[model samples]
Target: MKVSVVKIGGNIIDNVEALDTFIQQFAQLEGLKVLVHGGGKSASALMKQMGLEPQMINGRRITDAETLKVVTMMYGGLINKNIVAGLQAQHCNALGLTGADANIIEAHKRPVKEIDFGFVGDVDKVNIAPLKAFFEAGLVPVFCALTHDNQGQLLNTNADTIASQIAVGLSEAYEVSLKYCFEKTGVLMDINDESSLIAHIHQGNYSGLKADGVIADGMIPKLDNAFDAIGEGVAEVQIGKAENLLQKEFIGTSITA
Candidate 1:
């Protein structure tokens, strides 16, 4: 059985009708075992609605103690349940879970050094047993990136990091293909130019491309996670657009070992 981990970004979640369309397309994939990791567009919106200003540090949420609660509720509770419900409506048995469930993902609370972000976690380990049980049971494991430390204190982890961790974990447990679908078609040579999708990228060229300023902003972290997964034995990392998701031929940049 081939398992595939598909991470749908926050940008995609923001569009309601578009998301529904994607879900319909995703459900149609034949014999595909999938895992989904989503982020906080709705969560951030809810935080703002409640008069809490969301902060970001180096593209990650500055999850202070108070903000951590907001994030947990938003991502793990609202968004997680909503997506699961949507998938379930399509008759897809998608199970929503947090990283803390069955210690499926374990993290250590990263101490504040230069950054004063509270309760942010860096994933140190991921246990794929529970995930395997769900997948083997014919359920799509939809994980919301929230994890905990030894003390069982909940910590906020980066969504991309969570996606990469799941990809690695799934790869280790089964032979799987990993796909990172976002707003962009792929890593472009020119940030302003949409047509410049890099067809193929290698480990050595990744550095040079970033140095040359081809990889910028959000794409850098996504690419880093993709490369990290590839290094950890994931067969391939394809970054692409949401609408083109159904296509057999990947139009985005392919990161290969």
Candidate 2:
């Protein structure tokens, strides 16, 4: 089976109309599929509402215990369910899940280093059996950025990493396409110019692109995850705006080994 594991950015999730539009596009995505979402915006909003100031180190959220609780309510409960409901409204059967549900994924708390990223989880394993079962049963699984330690702890995880790892896991059983959907058209040479989209990328020029500062900051980690997925046997990986998800003609930065 050919499967698409599509991830939507937190910025889209923060916008009501953008999220609905993205969901509509996603529902129309062909073949067996999975959805992974980021909810940092929602989580941060809620944290502020509750009088907790959100903190970050190097663009990654400092997910302390309190932030974990907020994210659980937002990412796992509100955002995930709303997307599932929207998919259903579009006549697509969707199953919303966390890594804890049915043990779909297991993760360990990020070990404390110079900075303790409290309660943040780095994925340890992805159990594809349950996912394969969901696919065979003709269900699309929508995942939120939450995972368990197999010890009753729900940890905050990076949704992009979760999506990439899930794609890698599914590659063993399916021809997988891992997609990173966000605000940009594609990976661009100039951040300000949409026309400068780097339509195709591979290992050969990726390092050069990075060295030239075309790919820097958060994009670096995202592309790293993409390359990791490619190296681990995923057939295809692309990054582009969420709006172009279902286009008959492809438009994005296609990553290859």
Candidate 3:
């Protein structure tokens, strides 16, 4: 059995036309598949309207008490439903979910070290039974970036981490191909030059790429997560533009174990 666990971030979701196009492309992907999506500016935009200033540190949102409510509504309710509805329009049956639903994903609050990232979660487990059941029912599971403590409290989790963990968990039953699709056309030697895209990366060369400063900042964690997933039995991992999602030829940076 083969499954493609594709994750699309804020860049695609924020754009109306881009999301619709991606949904169409997602419907075209072969075999069993799952979609993990991140909330864009919608949550923060709604927060601002509600007189709450969004806070962030090192590219991660600071999900406080009030912020958590907005995220739960925006991520789980609005954004998730829209994507599910779009998939339905494409004749693809997508079931929208949160980690809280079906107890699909379990996570714990991040212990405070220096920064107190209130209500943020680090994933602890991915339950594959429901996922497998969903797949058998011909349903594509669409997940939002919200997890729970199994104690009724919802926590804001990173979407990339959620995707990686889910792929690793699903690897037990399927030959998994995990994809981290975003705005860029893969890992670039130069963020400005698309031609500088690095088409391949593996454990052997990853450290060197970081030493050369080709991979840094936010991209570093994403690559680390990809490598972690690959090491944990995921057959393949790729990072690239959402535009190239359905292409038979993967025109993106392939990460290997």
Rank ordering of all candidates by TM-score, starting from the highest: 3, 2, 1
Off by over 4 Å in 3: 57-59
User: What is the C-alpha local distance difference test score of each model?
Assistant: 0.79, 0.90, 0.93
What shift in Å separates residue 127 of candidate 3 from its native position after superposition?
0.6
TM-score preference between candidates 1 and 3, better one: 3
Model 3, 95-174: lDDT tens per residue? 99999889999999999998999999999999999999999999999999999999999999999899999999999999
- Give the range of the ten consecutive residues with the poorest summed lDDT in model 2: 241-250
**Pairs that collide, model 3:** none
Clashing pairs in 1: none
Task: Tell me the tens digit of each residue's lDDT in model 1 across 3-61.
Answer: 77777877777788878887876776655556465663776787788898888889767
Candidate 1 Cα errors over 4 Å, as ranges: 55-60, 204-213, 216-218
Task: Provide the clashing-pair count of each candidate structure.
Answer: 0, 0, 0
Q: Which candidate wins on lDDT?
A: 3
lDDT score at residue 190, model 1, on the 0-100 scale? 78
Better of 2 and 3 by lDDT: 3
Which pairs of residues have clashing backbones in candidate 2? none
